[model samples]
Structures are given as C-alpha cells and as structure tokens.
Target: MLSDVFGDPATIDETAHLVGEVRLIRTVSRAEAQRTTRFVRHGRA
Candidate 1:
C-alpha cells in the first residue's frame, strides 16, 4: 500500500491497528497531496 509505504511509522501503525489491513491508493501527485493535507486541516477540498 502506498500509505503503508509512505506514511509515518506511527500513522502506519495506528492505521493498521484500526483497519486490520493497510490498503492505500497508489500514485498521487504533489498537488494532490498538498490539497489533501489542506483539506484535512481546513475541512475544505
């Protein structure tokens, strides 16, 4: 999983604990990542 590969160790562990499996979307653009972070923090996409 891309998240499993790219996520911070703590985030990966927490997600694994909750989800039981790590499934992640592959190949996101830098702009997309930045947009996602902004949306997550600001609640607007």
Candidate 2:
C-alpha cells in the first residue's frame, strides 16, 4: 500500500509493525512512478 501525501518514518514503522512486513518508498509525485499507488489513512490516528 502507498500513501497519497508524505509518509514519515514513524508512520512507516507503525505500519510495518502492524503488517509484520512492509516497505515504504518516498516519492514526490505518483507520476514519477510507473505503477500508481496512494495511501489514505484511517480515522484512527
């Protein structure tokens, strides 16, 4: 899964811990990547 906006290290770590295995890549824009990906977080912080 990917995020729409910027994803900080803490956020990535949290996700990784929950999912058990996750890799986060920082990107300026989706257009920069070949495959489209965006992450929208839940209401619970």
On lDDT, the candidate that comes out on top is 1
lDDT of 1: 0.67
TM-score, prediction 2: 0.31
Residue pairs in collision within model 1: none
Residue pairs clashing, model 2: 2-38, 2-39, 3-39, 4-39
**How far is 28's C-alpha from truth in model 1 (Å)?**
6.9
Tens-digit lDDT string for candidate 2 (1-45): 355443787787687676653223333344435333322233322
TM-score of each: 0.32, 0.31
Lowest lDDT 10-residue stretch of candidate 1: 20-29
lDDT against the true structure, each candidate: 0.67, 0.48
